[model samples]
Target: MNNNEHLTKRRGMTAEDLLRLRSVRDPHYAPDGTRVVFVEKSIDEENQYRSHLYMWTKDGAVRPWTFGPWRDTKPRFSPNGETIAFLSDRSGRTQLWLLPTDGGEARQLTFFKNGVRDYVWSPDGTFLIALTTLGDDETIEDREEPEKAEVKRADLKPRVVERLYYKSDAAGFLDGKRAVLARIDALSGKIEALTGREEEIGSFAISPNGRTLAFVANRNEDPDTTFTRDIILLDLEKKTEMNLTNGCGTFASLGWSPDGMKLAAIGHDLAYLGATIHRLYVFELERQTKRVLTADWDAHLGDAMVGDTHADAKSPGPIWASDGSGLYVTASERGRVNVYFVSLDGPIAPVVEGDFHLYGFTVHPNGRQAVAAISSPTSIGDLYAVSLADGTKTRLTRANEALENEVVFADAKPFTYQSTDGWEIQGWIMKPPELGEGEKAPLVVEIHGGPHAMYGFTFFHEWQLLASRGYAVLFTNPRGSHGYGQSFVNAVRGDYGGMDYEDIMAGVNAALNRFDFIDKERLGVTGGSYGGFMTNWIVGHTDRFKAAVTQRSISNWLSFSGVSDIGYFFTKWEIGCDVWEDAERLWHHSPLKYVQNIRTPLLILHSERDYRCPIEQAEQLFIALKRLGRETKLVRFPDANHDLSRTGSPALRLERLRHIVGWFDHYLKGPFG
Candidate 1:
């Protein structure tokens, strides 16, 4: 009975172990850095999710360069490393394909009409540049009729809404189709229209003497009532255009400098609007001059770490360093998301610091190496390599290493305390892997949803399925999160439910005075979208949670400043006011104006196309908690959005993790019969 206790038995993590976790994502490299590629994803036994394209190799050989059951993704590579391109959906829609590295057979470039929402590779490998979406009288020769570009009907046309940024909990109703930027013909796929501009472009780069491109848009004059992104540049062979942040601020990931005379990016200047932070600027394309490079660095540069498994992870923005010597970027800090480097004369450092979650990277054309992707609190993501001269790493893709050799996850820990005005915060916890000696358990808490995103060390399958059912999870980062800087994320913008609900109840009394097997009367709580408006403002201001769920929430900032979709400038930028400038200061920062002082037992869950907190804010908190009878419920999901628990629909993200572990095991384990 001892082959090391049968190879270390294992068990815990379930909710169908999120269909055996995989994810990986956007690695790239291969312009002769000895190949890398990436993508992975997973889920199928009919619960669907798929995504392919692999590769790896620096002799640690990995393989699978695209397989069927389509959904391949952003690969890239090509500047004569002989083709890779990517973004697939195997022809039924998301186009731009390619493949080739020494072999053959992977063609289909871009038929347009609606597919390909991003591309790139044009440092002189005969162009590719993409990003699609057309209609204002569409054309790319009306997508050359592949049966009218694979017809799919169901338009039912009636969205005539005139933009105040019409719909997007990830592309839902923006049907006036704008995005643009074309070019193609990477060996005759033909395409053309590179920026017919009407403002939608956002994030682009191209220039290493490929005659400039640079991008990021917002051509003002009602580009959806302004956040003015600017950047511009253009001139791909004298088509001429210039701007470069004249609209002054809110930029995006752009990069560019191998000697094309600088450009970097990642932005800000709405100075604490949606809780600002995002620094590192550097422009100078021949004296159009700009500089910031982390003006006295504070954190929040690219990957603001919040997890639910890195799905579609792509944010290695400002990478440069092949000889530009100063780029890399990934930032976030305090709860970790590392990879720093910066230096365009200023300093910055930390080329990959620790406690996990790097979330995508690339470099290595000998900038001494990088690859990355990472993830941790028990790895549900892979691809490593690293080094960049002494941080070391290696790993590379055991995808989920047989779901970590059959389950058992839990880890987290990390602490820190002081809340309200003493400030500090930053949390974590976890516990319960089958608790026993002095047994106690049951606790939950888990909030994250970008009160400007941060929760740290990645891999969170609903906090390891509530610490594998025995609960005790916790999670923190309060006071408007995002790696603790820019005034603690603009101190939760104008204080919604003030002091970020007392920094998440002082991180649940600092995890019940630093965990003594947690239990404090078996609590429970949840979150989603501003942590589901702070789990409906912590059960309408504390009954000390004996269960609550919330998801994709927000309960009435006066009908969420007119039905959400960034609710009229995110309710005047995070409740500073505006329903005609103070609908009683957004009902004194709403949670359905303290829903009759709720008494826990909630649930809610939402997402019938949540246009970001818009399942009518979970049907007005389940019809005002069923007209005050309380012990509420709700559910929803159909064609979900507001990313139903991160990139939804893999059987509704496993039935929203079994309705959040069956409503915290029916009111913290003891009722349900």
Candidate 2:
């Protein structure tokens, strides 16, 4: 009924109680199914991250294992039960360290200058295979010679060399063939270089017996093509290598089945964003045949996230139901991301349902209980545990409780409206709770990102925070959003701000007509990426919103095509050609086209390091608003990416929230006496 009640916290709030407040991620029961370990993260004074590992007794007692004295993390129990391997940067570099599960001194395993990037303990517990790289070898001459430099009088900026075609938002440019694979011997403290070739290991998985490794990488390949990683299988024992998934370059993944005979992974066929593909492949190594799992364009393969841990969906397969009658898989089917169990061979049916969509899921080791995160626009993901047999769902984590305790959630009512030419548009409306009998609530129209990404049950942490502040929030899936089908998501291809914009405003108008308490005079609008662009587009066309916040948005398509690394490709797919080929089309869809008609006060939130929607986009909009004498402000996060609001640096994510709320407080809810 209440937040504390929902939290299931039995007693007075202790430091442990506060620690429990942060959502726990990747909770796994040990092989014996006795103890549990998870990552507990929090932001400190500087808004920087300080994450520590905590161990839980099966009976409910909890203890901090890896110390937080210098930011310890990711504790994984070795199968043999002798040691727990984890990563800690206490040494000033992120490296692998091992702690004895039975209380012993934690010792350093590898001493590399560049550090161990990410590690996975081999099943046999013999070694921990790490994917890491040091900056390319540089000589004293390679280092800037301050004494011999031409620009010695002025400050020197580091020269960044982009090695490949497209760069990543998190890890920029592909560089000078510097990646290496290392296997740290658990017992000997010796490191063997498994890969020193002129390529970087992208994604990999170990063979069931732990004798072989399968991965995707670009070795001795082109440095110009954006997608260059080739899938290869290497024998750990023999140090021999063989190409597994060929021709399907740039990105590839491999999952070994329980029998070790079959591999299930998706090979890219013109993958956009190096992800978001329409096909999945199951390979029978012996028969040497590949089966296209799903050919439906609407269906997408969620991130593989291959781990040192066994692939749950393949081989050993979704914890057997005791009788081995069926297998469970959380997939996008019919219309939503659902959990379903198909007979080891046949029909599939939904295990969970509603308008919301499912993201991450984990099945209990015992095969009896399962926990998953379900969410929607207004609600962020809430942890829930369900019975594998009966399919009865029980909520676990009360993430929204504290916010809901002091404030009420506007009930998200779903309704459908007509788009311009009679196409039906569906959306949800939220009315602020605790509204006075006669007072009206201001409306906040929220647009979602991924123009192709769907809006469903999964929660949006920001939306709840907004609803808590007494604003009625409106969000809808436009013609280009997901959940309906393939055609719907791709509708905006080669054309954004066209029919999609029309579809979005139609839904907004429908919400206004349906809700009486919504104050049309005090409307506020906000969104990130595609949504932000729409927000900019909305203010350009209508003066309805008193204030607006455009986060990480694109203003001029011409600048976007050149400034954004992926701009060359995204603008290509979105508008059907390169910037030079479609200059007219680019200018036509750009939100800047309507800049002269804009009237509302606007605030732009951007991250300095965001490569997706570059900071320049925000700069463009801010300068435009300032030139027109519009009340506007720009909030910039120092080292965050496009994902800052979701999984950016902890401190930056917090600041992002504060800045958004602060801007609205000053404009939408403000001029406070």
Candidate 3:
């Protein structure tokens, strides 16, 4: 063999050969703003899943900070920059740990016996706030005691319901206990229970003086905004609470000034109909007054949600300057959220712009430096630093060289499809680069979760792999997908699988009709969670596809309400009714209701540790498929969750891609791979 042939041999010619590959996500900046920290995951020669934390000198000098077989994630620097806290399961249970920046043995902090899911340090750097299910032995036993019981001072007066979307794939009848917040001292190591209310705490922050905490919570908010939450200010010393935003809608993003005199939040554009605006409001804390930052400018609502819950792709809506000179918020043009600076009192200007989505930016106390997670539709997120004044950006991490090495598919051909009733739907076509002998390639119709979520131009690892392997992949943002206006996003809120099914089918039809290379005889469908439910619904509705894979999907809405978390809220907000009141709606929407109609060879992929969608949903589907005497196989991923495809153990994530590719290859692309 020639030298070039030997070089090609050394290189990975097939996708399977690309084992020494990894991807970076959730890039966070250190407190000093001079360095960056991110998680790197890769498979070894033996294909073992390995992950480690790596640091970069803002100029891009990258190296590992931790070394071991165990996984490490969620690294956050203390405000003082002396310690970094993160979650690790090295001790067999995911727990919080503190480590010195100079790097040595990371000392484990929390030992609750079970595990901890989320944690954050207070602004004063003296305390740490953590959230974990207080279902501990002591707590559970305490609940068992009748002494804790109290009269219902105020009844919940739960409302009735009447729609399909009411029953979530995760929580069916939707009645489960909610999570609460707890606090711990960073130095003293003392712990305290902050709230005993059975309501979910969304996001929170510490006031400048560190005496009060503001969080978007459902502690005592209105019942109608179950899908939403209100901002609550809890005075720590006084132990008093005040509800700020009232019971409006869901609030996901917020920013606080250096002095804590003002607060900015990104939320509903309730001022106008068909307008999806993320209104940034500045509330004077003491005066109790609110002022709109973009009061003069036309609001930017980036998605197809009710009143634009989609953030501006350009900015994340607001991170304040250390000097309190201005605020940084994700600004958007269409489908892009770029980090941009807006003066506190002047026109909101773009310090950053382009077709990219941004996140995890930290502003320097000096105001000269900032680091953000930056990525475009064609690229994966890596660490980047930008000058807040000039908006000059420097890429700091080369997380993935796989995309550059392999001719991974990225560009999508945009097209729209019309439903049976003439509703125009958007879809994308991704084709392989190598087409030989005018052969028709197999097709895989992939669906996205978050019936309200938009499937847009974001980079997807599995989709790229599928396209690279010679399948014409078709995906779309149907009526319920975001990035369009609110009317479109909420279109499926009450109907879910009904019109939404037709919308997706129309896209598949469009792909088959518009693209001559698609082989109709060799077609497959797959999706996760909501997509899973839709896939089950699709199979029962029609026998068009030869095979299907449904991952983390809901088979029965009625069962989901109780089995899944957030059951109480899930049934009400989306469906507008309780399971009993809308029994027919739940039945009509369930994929199991028509399981007998499923003839396509099906595969059920689920993670046992998935709390968001729960593994039981997958179990039910697998059982139903087996009982029907249909061709089906179940791939159970242990210790993984609903976000498995995107952020699970690297080896398992690749395994997921492998199984997905293997299934379609078996049914669609002739199985040789």
Candidate 4:
């Protein structure tokens, strides 16, 4: 039962092995604390990720609580511990389903026309509140109407955009529908609309007394221009809502105190724009006042690294203690995610500290124990019981035993070196497993997507695949990456390809100097998003690398600012200027402006529906390179968005892996003849 057994005499890892790995996520301890319920995710034969709840105990006994091929997630134990409520798509649409913990047939709770997006049980266990988007029509006929309209392609009408925020990478075209919060009775199955027609709810949480709710929303006249959001307190009985933050700052992760006398949440004042560090705050319900708890903390409060390929990654919000003394929260600091204890009076300390990333965790009622989902470079992911008192983490489930037994995972070795400007940069190198004596392997310098996201010890399937294929993978945290101080993460702003590029190149030189087995002559570079931008920039600026692959990249900032879903605000926020204001500066930073200098063979991967960077980014690069008679190829994934590599179709993910491996092998590894 050793977790590292697969590293012993195991064969190389393959992309197909990714399907066999079972992902463990969303572990919720029953109210009694005797048993735990979690979702075990696996790739089904039909190329879909299927998740079902499994009942687990402290003694290592495990059994399936729900049997289904459909996706079932977010299992929660009722406050009374009598019933388990979860979201499922078993009825063809995702809806809330309730099942008695003692064992019985499950009952469908709600059948809304648009289906439920998210739901949470009231503290009394009497009502279930859910968030969903509704159309202009609010009649019974509209409520029962199916979401999919049967219309021929030729008969489709033109889509008109009347809002500035007309599209999103996750939801596609904005339907002009508002997301409303609705309440459903646990027994009678009666539905009640709690929000007005135009009230658009973002995120919410019910009070411990089930009397009031705290939710986030953008109620400004023009939400597109307004970057700030406020937390609103809604009284269920009185049906009156009051703005709590009063435009103080952007707030989210709402949590009610045990006594329902205070509210705890996390957010920032946009001091650093998109890269601003988040701080925890507490609002006094009785006094109608608020105070910042983690104002001095410099690290990002929640998990924003985003390297995990696991399909069921859950966001662990701030968990309030039973006695209302303090709350537990997850924070990303220096390439690791750790849970911290923060008191209302401004005392903050780490509860669980480690190099590994704790993506999700659930605090028990006792406040000393928690079930956490952890992932590292050597291991995919597993559930563990974390003792908050002594910092002891006990493995609770071995969900990926098949992957561990068959794949020899290459562990990332930490390293640090000063960049060209003497700024210290942290990085990791994953050497190819079992390399022969005196044999140097081809090196692949990897860059992370978010220039703001840090490349840490999280288990990355794509990196493992490349390492297994005899390529030493090198990745580093540059100036813009999180986990560092605010000043460091903000260094890349207004200097897209400036010092950050020098930091990455310096990291590569350090890795090559430290590892003699890395063949510098057969080096390669690749990245997505900001990483992709760096990849394109790297090739256009220098011919040091023999090959490069840019996925879902941004080539021209000027065009991107106009076409990208987030480019309008994102460009102005991250780049420090608008396209109309400083077109010359945008062109100067764009890789497309210097496309004629690219000498390395480039592989461009993009999704057709990618609204983030927009496929036009890739197209612009490919067309420019091809027109110049350069070695470049474009691979477009259909029906996929910006997250193609991580959450796209299983078959498409594997195909992407093959293409990457094939492209690298052709240029850096092999002689097909």
Q: After aligning candidate 4 to the native by TM-score, how far in Å is the CA of 66 from where it should be? A: 1.7
lDDT by residue (tens digit), candidate 3, 496-519: 678888899888888888898888
Q: Which candidate number would show the highest lDDT if scored against the true structure? A: 4
Model 3 earns a TM-score of 0.77
Per-residue lDDT of 1-673 in model 2, one digit per residue for the tens? 8954543432211111222223434444566756666555544555555667766655656676765546666677887666777778887777788888799888988767666666777878888888677556731112121233366656776657654344668676545536677777888867777887666676677877998887777654564444545667789989999876566534444556666776656555654433244444566678878665455434544422111111121211232333444445555432356666545445555675556555546566687777665554434345566676777877655544664343334457778889997777777777655556677887788887767665544444566556666678887778776556556666778768788888987887888788888877778888888889889988898887788889889888898877776776677777777777868888888888788788888889998888889999999888888898877889999878887776666556657767776676666777620
Range of the 10 consecutive residues with the lowest summed lDDT in candidate 1: 143-152
Best by TM-score: 4
TM per candidate comes to 0.34, 0.83, 0.77, 0.97
lDDT of each: 0.82, 0.66, 0.68, 0.87
Error at 154, model 3, angstroms: 41
How far is 301's C-alpha from truth in model 2 (Å)?
3.4
Q: Any idea what lDDT model 3 has?
A: 0.68
Worst 10 residues of 3 by lDDT: 305-314
**Local distance difference test, candidate 2:** 0.66
Candidate 3 shows a clash count of: 37
| Candidate 4: residue 13 Cα off by (Å) | 0.7
